[model samples]
Target chain A: MAVTGMQAELTLGPIPFHWSREEKRDFYARIADEAPVATVYLGEVICSKRAPFFETEIPETAERLERGGKRVVLSSLAEVMLTRERKATADLADMDGVEIEINNAAGLLARAGRPHRVGPFMNAYNEDAIAWLARGGATHVCLPAELPGEAIAVAARAAAALGVEVEYQVFGRAPLAVSARCYHARAHGRTKDNCQFVCEEDADGMPLATRDGRPFLRVNGIQTLSESYVCLVGEAGALAKAGVGHLRLMPQAVDMVGVARAFRDCLDGRKDPAEAEAELVGLCPGTRFSNGFYHGVAGYRKIAADAAAMADR
Target chain B: MTQAELVCPAGTPAALRTAVDAGADAVYCGFRNATNARNFPGLNFTPEELAEAVAYAHRGGAKVLLALNTYPPAGKTALWREAAETGARLGVDAFIVADMGVADHVARTHPGTRLHLSVQAAASSPEAIRYYCESFGVRRVVLPRILTIPEIRAIRKEIPCEIETFVFGNHGLMVEGRCSLTNYVTGQSTNMDGVCSPASDVEYVRSADGSMSSCLGGVTIDRFAPDEKAGYPTICKGRYLAPHRAEGYYAFEEPVSLNLARMLPELVAAGVHAFKIEGRQRSKSYVRSVVSAFRRAVDDIRAGVAPDLADLVALTEGQKETQGAFRTKKWR
Candidate 1:
């Protein structure tokens, strides 16, 4: 089944949860020492309220990752609403010493004409956007998780033509929305300002269920994520063939190092996709795996393969 | 000239006419496709209808702005470009755009066409608004509903372009252009597909107990008592259950409409250039009633009279309204 010669690299996405400083420090240390990821993104991509806690640890973590021979990109907030958030985005854009990835429209102006990465939150959905961002110094782009495999293939091709690298999240709970209001704080009968770091209690984010008692989503401060982790292990062959140069694995509470190794094994043809899928299920025992968004179906469903892609092949 | 111009929505030609006759300075409508946000069936105008609508609005001494806001999907941007060109050719006053590519194309191709940055761009900060203004010569920006009055005042001092604020209609609590809660449960996307909890996929089941449950796709968003009014199943306004609250609660936001009817003077004092009303999918009578009421309110404020707007509450979602985020940090 592994008939392609092209190999895809793996990237570690930023943590979407609010973990303690020691927890974050230990995670980064392990990643620097043991994980097989090529690039690591560090930042508070969700809520501005959670930024103050771990913002100081970013420089140190980036340095540690750099020592481990990994490319480090500092990501700006996915939603830049507050005045202080805008200032922080501008300040990060002005820093030329480190590579930066901008997620919001606020960072686009200052970061223009210089090299930077584009996060999925920017919604790089079409070719024209990819081409436009390329002109504005976007050397790399992590396409949004909602895009199907066919759409991603089209975007990857457009990005490849511009010499821009494309990264797709192949694992981790997909981020569905970012709101100005914090659901996590609201659940505890508290506002975001007085959240009291309530989100820190659930290291993997608080579980949210539908009215029918079906577990559907995870609430992490202002961000709403899918209950099912996006697992595109089955599509690894097609993804590599589609010119997707890098596969992203978002940071979760699971054994991410093992998860990275498994995906790397499948992409590198060292392990069968089914074998890797089994390993993923073992590593993330609490959640189900879904490839629905990749198959042009509901993001919560677990479709096996793209029938349209199979027909085309 | 009045202190601020009022921009109203027109889902159809009749609504367009209704908005103008009700004292709207400008009316915004979209083509019947994914090029705009409210791309529902039986809503929006066709190209020919738009030409007629523009002519009719101009005859009534009002400007018509065409919304081409939704982000075009990968490998399929031509539809959006053609829509923009057709709107420009039809003599629409301005184009409300969200995606940078569409804005870029409009700026370079139709050099003098006025561009208003849609709230779908989610550019809430002054720097973000400035980026759009400087990059594409955007004349105005529909500020996201996530800002406070003071925050809006602070932004007004920094940006180079005119700012438009929503004074009535849906309490859009989510940061626009970025939220994807609808996409997870339903296959349709608000950003790319231009539909959120699309009507085709929504179902309401009545319980044997005379209560009702609203479902988006196969998942239930909220349950209602027999006497409670059922609203559209917007994912953000849905009730959900968590460990902290065994009983379900409105985790993101409740089903309430944003009515800034009482705060007109303060918004005008903040140097707002336009007041926006956000019901593109509403009925003709709704357009007539709401627009006329707001019309009187705007005029009353100008005449230095206190406007009585209590009657407008009967038209809000859940028959309830909120001055969300504008009054205070509802959820700091």
Candidate 2:
């Protein structure tokens, strides 16, 4: 848990979109074989209706990643409303040989007395809350993506003191909110119960634009994500210095292995942070990039490094 | 019929007296600080005002619930701790809290005080609700504005805490306490600053073509036609363009108020212990009229008669109201 002299581990966060089961299998197959991530988070973290489609393939995916020398973790849904969702989360607690990442409090209650990771959606914003979760057997916690750097440092220090590892989202679209109503289904002129799984049509998620035609967010079933990918490749050193023990890269419909490599290289000091940022941009064409949330500005605003450095001073 | 308690919003000392006079079983208010969600300028109660308001509500045989609901920023939880300590010292009936740190502080420091989980906590499932009840001794949970009545009935059977539902006011479609869209656009968030679409950052401009546009943080959130009435510039309620849609539509939710006055008996039968109203920044007349209407509705339900729900449109947002997700599962 010591911040200094500790190499930050690169982790692939759970996929939040709805892709085909075969596509998911192929994606994980490539990730396991080629990605340089130290840990892999699998399972559905969005709507429960989408879980059954991929549930059968999870064990194989986990096994393949484990064979590739990666630690596999299963993530619970962010919002658990249906009874079946609750049951599925409780069932995950009994799964052997893998840790669980709890996005909802229901998962925490079900996995009582067991070591687990608290996902970003659980809202551990302060030191006291992080300590509380650590007391409840949480070994790691991914702080919310909207937090600024100072807050992250404070929480990271508290977690480090409690012997808990703190992870921060460094790539992919930041998940901003989750709701009971499925916006994707509603957009398709269907109800959530009988929508026929139309979210599968958009691999990255359906883009939401402002009235002026500015891409503002992406709608994936019940969750809303920032339109721009949150790229902290430029701040790897700063984040590590802030005591962040892990850098999480959420999976998207891009060259994820390349994305993982860029982050891995940047964190390992094998490549310059600016060069890694350029490589990431080239990997995901036509997507905006942002690191403003870390600078305590609007999430969509990308502050220039020199300006950010001056502000830090 | 079982009687469900009516919880009304008291934004100020005057509003507290007005709600109590109009027959509120309990009034919920917040200190004038960032600790509460309705942290608007010229609204909420000062510490002295809150102390006086609690005394006034207690004198009228009603309870006061102080909302310390906003998540405290890191390394600055003293504000929330002070609010809880002040509320406990002033003899408030319960503390409506959202953050785990605030809840833990209140539970540990003021063990005798009741803790009601705010809707902002978004505890939708029984396991999540029970976690709060078991972990922090939360006595009741203001259920999120999402669950259907059947879902509430199922949840009530599973958890050991009282259930509270929003009976009237803002129909927030987004998950409470989790949304950072405001911050994404305006660099301020309800979870951190207790303000969503802060009024100072809102702008309404009348274009030369006779159309109107509502803007937030310099971004045009929605546009209104010459014949259409403009709504407040909340990020969630605005119309937005999406793929495969020609025109902009309400991607999240429209500007509609939630009016569940007709479902009182059904909610009571579903084991709802309290019905909460959602406006703390509304006028004193709003506090009085809405609280009085629900008060009579509850009484009429107990008397085995149909409750009247007319003349509420004038007070609704955008002058439109819906039952929201209370009676249906297809609200999206």
The residue ranges of model 2 lying beyond 4 angstroms of the native Cα positions read A1-6, B311-318
> Residue A233 deviation, candidate 1, in Å?
1.1
Give the TM-score of each candidate: 0.96, 0.97
In model 1, where do residues sit more than 4 Å from their true spots? Answer: A1-6, A306-312, B308-318
Q: Give the per-residue Cα lDDT of candidate 1 at A176.
A: 88
Query: Best DockQ goes to which candidate?
Result: 2
Output per-candidate TM-scores for chain A, rounded to 2 decimals.
0.95, 0.97
Question: Any residue pairs clashing in model 2, and if so which?
Answer: none
Q: Candidate 2's residue-wise lDDT over A1-313, tens digit each?
A: 4343128888999989888888989998998899999899998999899999899998889999999889998998888888788998898865656899999899889888589999999999888888888889899999999989889888888888899899999999988888889999888888899889989988998998888788888999999999999999877678888899789999999999999888888877788878888899999999999988888888888887788778667
Best by lDDT: 2
Q: What is the lDDT of candidate 2?
A: 0.88
Point out the worst 10-residue segment of candidate 2 chain B by lDDT: B309-318
For candidate 1, list the clashing residue pairs, or say none. Answer: none
